[model samples]
Structures are given as structure tokens and as C-alpha cells.
Target chain A: MLWEMSASHIEESQDVTSQDLDEKLDLLSLQCLFLMNQVISMKVDIERRMKEGTGMLAKARYVMGGSSVSTLQIPSEEAGMTASTLSSFEESERMIGKSLRLKYYNFRVFPSAKVKDDTEDEVKDGIEQKLSNLQLDPRQSQASNPLRWFGVLVPNSLREAQKIFGGVLLLCAECSSIESELEAVIREIDILNQVKSNRQQK
Target chain B: MSDFPSSARPGKLLAIIGDEDTCVGFLLGGIGQLDKHRKSNFFVVDKSLYPSATNIEEIENAFQQFVKRDDVDIILINQHVAEVIRNVIDRHTSPIPAVLEIPSKDYPYDPSKDSILRRAKGMYTAEDFR
Candidate 1:
């Protein structure tokens, strides 16, 4: 009888141990799922902002060109219109470029191996470096060509967005930040487990 | 004396003075010379037309004329251009036309380094907000 009791107790202990391990695994898996969701959301937000910035820039450029072509009848009027439009376009381009650069900087500061792999960090870095060089070029200082600036700034902004998305992914991994939806799922599972335990106890 | 927005003015104009890119950007924005017949709405003066040393004088003259005209509402100048005519820009007190310094294509927009931002920071620091 003592042997039998010992065997039963050993079986009970083993069951409890397995249950504990299962709970731990469940929690870990839930956390990982949550983190993934957060990273995806961050990437979406960054992309949306980038698109908006680029769209604004393109619109401004179109306006600048359209206005200049139409105002050519009067020399003074044409000159003034041309100058103003060019300045506005330049400002728009600069603002967009700055936004992209900020994103790029954020991405560089936060490194995510998975997202970075998808973006191909080396390609992004090369593009950004080329843009930086273009900005530093002496010809840009001597002459202000709105068209040239537009060409360089737009592509740079797009590339910067790609880098930023990778950085956002890295931040999520580092902080273990999870999405609200995933958190809700984890909570629901925990509550269900509690209900089951209560019923079993009763 | 006029409380209306500058855009409502029959002769509201904006002047931009700076390098080729800066001037070109302004021009692209529809700023043209003063149209006496149609009520000029905007004007941009490219300082590149003047010798480097005379750039400030030309900008000052343009600003004086812009402000004197009841029609002009805003003046947008490149940061470098503003630097050239800092004395006049700083001394002018009327709010008829707002003056703003903008970044050119060659210059990156550095919010932290912007004079306006710097002033704000200074004010915040003085008030212990920072």
C-alpha cells in the first residue's frame, strides 16, 4: 500500500510539473505574437507618414511648374513668379528630405536584424550616403535648380522610410513592446485558464 | 490699419531673395513682379541679380518697398538671404506682412539649429520648462 501511495504521489507531482511548464510556454508564445503585431503596426505608421510627405512634395512641384509656365507673358511677373515658386518647392523638398532623414537616423539607432534583412540595409545606406554627397556638392550651392533638388530629395525620402521601418522593428524587439490586440488574446487565455482551474478545484 | 488677411489685399506680394535654387523655388511658387494694372499679389527679388556685397542693399530696398505698399502681405526669404538683410528684418515692426526665413535646397532643415527654435528653447529654459 505504501508503494502504491508513493507511485500515485510521484504521478501527481509529474503532472503538476508538466502543467507549470506548459503555462510558461504558453505565456512566452503569446508575448512573441504580441511583439510581432506591434512591429507590423509601427512599420505601417511610418510608411503612411512617408507617403503623405512625398505626396505633398510632388503636388508642390507640379504647382510650381504649372504656375511658371503660365506666367511667362510679362517679364517682371514671370521672373517674380518663377522665383517664388522655386523657393516654395525647395522648402517643400527640404522638409520632406528632413523627415526622411529623421526616419533614417531612427532606423540606424535601432537595429533589427529581421526587418533590416528584408529592407537590405546596405542598399539603403548607400542611397542615403549618395544623397548626403549630392547635398554637399558645390554646384548645388552655386546654383539652385528646383528640378534637380526634387529629383534627389524624393528618392532619398523613400529610401529613408525603408530604413525607418527596419528600425521600428528593432525597437519592438528590444523593448518587447506588444500590440494591444495580442495583449487582449493573452489575457483571454489567462482568464480561460483561471476558469478551468476553479472548476477543477470545485 | 487693415485687419483683413494679407491674401485679401489687392496687391499682397511675397518677395524671395537668395541663390539660384532659392530664387528658382520662390519663382516656381507663383511669386511674380508687382503688376500695377492687375493688383500685384506677390513679388520675388533674386539677390543673385546684384553683386554679392550689394545683395543686402537690394534686399533692404525690396523690403522697404514691399512694406510701404499697402498690398503686400508676406515676405518669405531664404535663411541666408535673411542673414544678409538681418538689420532691416529685425528693425521692421509692422505685422502687415509676416516675414519668414526658409531653408534652401542646399541647406538641410535642422529644427534644433533653427533660430526660431533656438529662441523658443531659450524662452523655455528661462521658464524652467526644459
Candidate 2:
């Protein structure tokens, strides 16, 4: 009877050891998942900042081309247009300011990649806050173009400015796409995991 | 500055005073001109003469001539070129031929040094909440 009891206790201890190992595996897997999420989100945030900055620059360029968000250019060649010029210069200054601010903020908030220690949620929240800070209110952005004072009313000049702005946006879009490769890896891993699980079942 | 270009104003000419690259670009942009006086609106400043428009007198003379011309209605000067002639630029009060400071091939346009932009900024009366 003593031998039988000893055998039973050994089996119970073995079961406890297996349970402990399983828990450790779960903890390690969570750590890995957390790291992956942080990396993905950081890439996404940086991309978002670039897109936002470029968009602001493009919009400002549009306005500088003599059209506002809500209104087109009026007969600004008149002497009375100085008031409008002031309002528009204010907007130009604001738009350049928005783009510059975002560029600088990105440099400050994302100095380097040592973000491995932070959890996924923390990384996401920090990025969201910075993005919101960089965003400009639509109302304040309606400032008109003061270039009319210089008689830059030609279609060719406007088109040239638009081309420059478009080129810049294209460059920003290029920078924003750098994360697509890593994101593709994430997608492939997901698909592979699903396929492996199905094969195991079969 | 006057509120409007005079009805008798001579228009359709663009005067350029910039570095080689900027001058070449604008000249290609269709503003190249050489008049009877052997005066070409395009003045190309090579760095070997001086870096970044260091010859203030030369730039000032070009800028003054461009501004005083009845045929040229717009003077497109490189921002650095304008920088050397800031005193003369600030002293200019005419609205006939507009003075525009443009970015060069290597230098960017700085609004702080822009006399017109500076004046516009100074005219702000209300407090900006931002």
C-alpha cells in the first residue's frame, strides 16, 4: 500500500511540473506578441505623421495657389485687398507652421527605436496624442493666398506651384510606404499560422 | 506702396538676379530678355566671385535697376541675393514692379528676412491665441 501511495504522489508532482511549464510558455508568448505589436504600431505612427505633414503642406500650397478651402480667389488686385492679404499671409504662415511643427514633433517624439520595453497600448496612446497635437483645425486653415498682391494671377504660375506641391506629397507618400514590407510579413505569418493549424487538425 | 499698378504700366517682363542654377532655371521658364541697352534682366552670380551674394553693392545695383525699370513689372530675385540688398529692399516702397524673393538652388526662402512679409507680420493687431 505504501508503494502505491508513493506512485500516485509522483504522478501528481509530474502533473504540477507540466502545468508550471505551460504557464511559463504562455508568459513568454505574451511577451513576444507584445513586442511585435509595439514595433508594428510604431511604424504605423511614423507613417501617419509623414502623411499628416504632407497633407498639411499640400493644402497650404493649394491655398497659396489662390483658392481657399471654402472660397475661390476674388478680385484681389484692388487696393482694398490689403486686408485680405494680411488674412492670407496669416494662413500661409500657419500652414508652413503646421508642417514644420509636425516634422519637428516627429523628430522629438520618435528620437530612436528603443521602444521595445514599452507595452503595445502605451506606444499606441503616445502616438495618438502626438498626431492629435499635429492636426490643424479646418476653420483656422481657410486663410486666403496673399500672392494676388503680386499679380501672380497666371494659370501657368499656379500650375507650376501645384506641381511642386504634388511632388512633395509624392515623396511623403513614398516615405509612408516603408512599413508595407514589415506589415506584409505580419500578414504572411498570420496566414501561415492558420494554414499550420488546419494541417495539424487534418 | 501704391494700391494698384498704374494703368500706363509696362508689364509682361520678369527680371532675374540669381545664382547660375536659379538664373538658368528662370531663363528656361521663358523670362530671358536682352534689350537695346545690352541689359539682360538675367544676372548670374558665380560663387567664385563671392559666396551667397556677398557682393552687396552688385546685388543692390541690380535690384535697384530692376525696380526702377518700366518694362519689367516683376523682379524675381534669389532670397540670398535679396539678403545682401536687404537695406535697399526695405527702403523700396513702390508697388509698381513687385519684388519677389525666391528660393535658390541651394538656399531656401526665409520669411524672416522678407521685407514685405515682415511688414505684413508687423501689421497684425490682434493677439494670436495659438
Candidate 3:
């Protein structure tokens, strides 16, 4: 009876040890999931913030560079943004900075990789000559804007759609021409089939 | 990666505007596309080329064309090359393809010249009271 009790105690200890191991495993897995979630969220957050900056800059430029404001006169709220819109935008601007810091935090010292050898003047002169040839001037801001004067031309989407529409129209025209050719070939085949049938009947 | 086709992914293509070494490194990573016209997804900026003027113009045009293309997802430009066309880079507004500045062989990346980072700093100075 004493031997049996000792055996039972040993079995009980083994069970407790296995249960402990299982619980530890579960906790480790949970921690792994949490870290993965954080990293994924950070990546998504960075992308969203970058996109936000691009969109806001474009919108701000459009409003500030409105055609009606030919002079440096104060732009009307109706031309671009209202007082409320500007204030809310001010709030989003803060979030934008925080997110960018997150992206730069790790690679902040990345530029240290560059080796300095060339004189600054030589580099600047080369770039200036290149810019002139490309008709791009660092002095002129609007020259680089791909969508410059777009605010005056058409709503951005309409312009994009017009380009897409032209492409689709070309595709449809090609398809119609091909279809006509196919119809002619099919008519010729039908007549040939009828002639074969007439000869078979004879 | 198994769930979706690669083409369906937003910003599926990465465009680069950098020096020969930078372009070659990216091309080795499988981002290079060459056409019959000898045009590619990247432009190699070589200061040693005979006509330095034409090289810069070509780089500027390549950068502009890449920005205008629909297939490109992200534009990675060397800080040195970006300096040459900083005005054009600053003027670009579309959010679909984000333009990012990277260091080159000769020049260190400047935080002050970073448009996005500069905008982010501007927000920190806003009036706030707790």
C-alpha cells in the first residue's frame, strides 16, 4: 500500500509539471502575438501618415495657389478651406509628425553612411546645370509640380477619369474592328458548310 | 504572399532615381524594367559622363516620368539626385506614390531638406496647453 501511494505521488507530480509547461507555452505564444500585432500596427500607421502628408500638402498648395488669388492677398475661406477645416487640419498635422518620427527613429543615423569627398560647389554647379537643362529651377517652385494649374483645369478625379476613358475607348474600338473581321470569316464558313451539305444531298 | 497576386498589391512597383551603384543594387533586387526605347524604371547619375548637363536633364525627366506613371508604388531618390531636382520633388502632391529621400555615395542625407519630415516638424510648434 505504501509503494502504491508513492507511485501515485510520482504520477501526480508529473501531471502538475506537464500542466505548468503547457501554461508557459500558452503565455509565450500570447506574447509573440502581441509583439507581432504591435509591429504590424506600426507599419500600417507609418504608411497612413505618409499618405496623409502627401494629400494635405497637395490640398494646401492648391488652396494657397488658387488662380483667383493672383496676388499675395489673403485667400477667401471659400476658395480653399474654412476656419473650422483649418483648425481640424492643425490637429491632424500633429499626428503626422509623431508617425514620421516613428519611421525615422530607427534609421535616424542612416546618412552617416555617406562619404564626403567632392567639393560642395562642384556638386551644386553640376546640379544647377542639370536643372536648367530639365527646365527645372530650385528658385521656381511651381515648375516641379506635376499637377500644377490642375485646380484651375478640372477636379482631379475628372482629369484622371478622362485619361482612363480615352484608354477604354481605344480598347473598345479595337475590339469592334476585330469583331467585324470575325463576322466576315464566319459568314464565309457558313456558305462553305451549305455547299458541302448540298453536294452530300445530291 | 500566398493569398493575393503580387500585381494587385498597391504600390507594387518601386521606382528608383539614384547613381549607377544605387540603381544596380536595386536592379539586382529585381526592380529594373527595360523597354525597347532603352528607357528604364531608373536613371543612373554619373558625374564622370562626358556631358554632365545631359545626364542631369535625363535624371530630371526620368524622375518626372516615374512620378507620373501609374504602375510605380514608391519612389526612392538619392539625396544628391533629389538635390538636383528638389523643386520638382517638393511640388509633387499625389499620395498614391510616396517619394522618399535616401543618401547617396557622395552626399549625406539632410533632414532639413526633407519635405515630409519638415512638415511633421511644423506641427510640433503649434500652440497647445494642457
Candidate 4:
């Protein structure tokens, strides 16, 4: 009688564990759905903003007419003369479930050299060294902006376009992070489903 | 469960493979960088500018370089540009240097075409819920 009672107890515990897995799987699937919706919305917003920015840029170019804005604004060659720092990324952690922490990349920016890099050594090269010193001149506040590379007097539309594109970069980064999280959640759900199926087979 | 690729160090740069306007706009946003080798972090995939039959091979080469580079962590490619190299993008399975498809001036985003969205859709089908 005692052996039969223990056997039933074991079966009951296994059933409870299976139920727990099912609940976890359900939650993960819901999370995946939520993340998918977020990514879709963000992508839509990015597309809309990009179109707006592109239109504004076109208007600015028309307003400029046959000027040297495009020809002179060669960013790759103007690296030494750059006042604004480049955008970067860093690792971030967020908890998705109990004992489930996800690590992903978060986009970061230090525009206008607000965050100084102590590690950057002073350049001793010929032309680059001179340009770097030119950037340090306090009177050249205009040089502090990457837009100055385009021209001294930029159109308002150009400035607006820059702002829009900059903002969209952040949205794109967020979408990347969330998509990664969703992938992780889906992977967990897959594992849980396999476990559930294996239990059923046994 | 090491989900991300092997990267003991954090990624430092966000590379771009976009058109002329997209490249110029983002470079103005202050994400442009050139290494000591004079190799730029951004690639200008402008077919109109070149007008010399700039082919998919050039764009694919830039994409491959960005992926191979250790410094670049995020690669933002225009959706239309990405379409030309969808096979390459799909083959890239690593999670560290994540490739994100973005809309360009002429091309709006299509969710059905997004790689991530496609994978997610496969997971939660009607049968899966049932």
C-alpha cells in the first residue's frame, strides 16, 4: 500500500513540474510576441523619419543650388578636423525572466567631445598634428560642429535633417537590442517545448 | 548558455553600409571614423554617384570587411542594399556584430523581409499556439 502511495506521489510531482514548464513557456512566447510588436513599430517609425529627413535634405540641396556643399564635405578625409566624437556601443544587461539575464549591445554617443578620451595620445604627424591643434582653438566654435564641414552657413533644413537622422540611429539601436532579446526568448521556449515533448514520450 | 559570440571585449564602432545621403547624414551625426590605416568605418554604397556600373560585388566586399573587422560591433545596412546581399547576411550567424536592416530614402521597411521578424514568425505560428 505504501509503495503504491509513493508511486502516485512521484507521478504527481512530475505533473507539477511539467505544469511549471508550460507556464514558463507561455510567458516566454508572450514576451516574444511583445518584442516582435515593438520592433515592427520602431522600424515603421524609422522608415517614416528617414523619408522626412531625405525630403528635407533634398530641399536643402535645391536651396543651395550649384554650390560646393557635397564636394567639399568629404567626411572620411576630414577625420583629423572632426570636432564631434564618433558613436559607439557598450554592453548592457537586463533581466527577462527569473535567472534569465540577457547581455546585449547598447549604442552610445559622445557628440562634440563632451566625453574626453584620456587614452587618445597626441598626434605627432605632420598635417594631422596641425589640424588637431586647429581644433583646439577656442575662437573656432563653429568648427565644434560636424555640420561646419558642409558649409559656414548651412540651411535650416539640413540641420533638421541631421537631427532626424541622429535620432533614428538610436531607434535603430533599440530595435537591434530588442530583436536580440526576442531571439533569446524564442530559444528558451524551444528548449522548454522539447522538454515537454520528451516527458510526454516517456 | 553563451548566446552572444565570443567577444571578451566590448565592440567600439557602429559601421554603416548606406547610400550617399544616408552616409552623409549619419557621418554628420558624428559616427564616422577612420582608423590609422585610413580605412573608414562607413562604406558609401552609392550607385548613382559612381555611374560606372558599381556592382553588388563592391557592396558585398564592404559588408564582408565590416563583418571581419573586430572593432565594428553593429552594421547598419539599408534594406535595399541588404537585399542584394541577403545570402551573405543570412549566413552571418554571430550575435556580437549584429546586422540591422534599415530603410533608405527610396525603400521603406517591410516587416516580412526582415530577417529577425521572419525567424520570430516561424516560432509562433497558428499551430504552435494550438
TM-score for each of the candidates: 0.35, 0.36, 0.36, 0.75
**Any residue pairs clashing in model 4, and if so which?**
none
| Candidate 2 per-residue lDDT over residues A48-136, each given as its tens digit | 43344334434544655533311123222333121210000000111111111001000011100111223434546543333323322
lDDT, candidate 3, equals 0.39
Off by over 4 Å in 3: A1-202, B1-11, B49-53, B123-130
**Candidate 2 chain B weakest ten by summed lDDT:** B1-10
Candidate 2 reaches a DockQ of: 0.01
Model 3 chain B: ten consecutive residues of lowest lDDT: B1-10
Worst 10 residues of 1 chain A by lDDT: A99-108
Off by over 4 Å in 1: A1-74, A77-202, B1-11, B37-51, B110-115, B124-130
Off by over 4 Å in 4: A1-16, A66-72, A76-103, A110-144, B1-11, B48-54
- Residue-wise C-alpha lDDT for candidate 1, range A1-202, written one tens digit per residue: 1112333333333444445535643553444354444444543443343344334444554655543322232344322222221111000011111111000001111111111122333545542342232222232222232233333344443333323323322322221222222322333333334444554687
Chain A TM-scores of each predicted structure, in the order given, are: 0.29, 0.25, 0.26, 0.65
**Candidate 4 share of real interface contacts:** 0.43
Which of 3 and 4 is the better model by TM-score?
Answer: 4
Worst 10 residues of 4 chain A by lDDT: A1-10
Give the per-residue lDDT digits (tens) of candidate 1, residues B1-130.
1322233222334554545434432333234444545434333445446445665576687667767766444555555566667677767644334454555444433444433333323422245432
Give the Å error, residue A183, model 3. 55
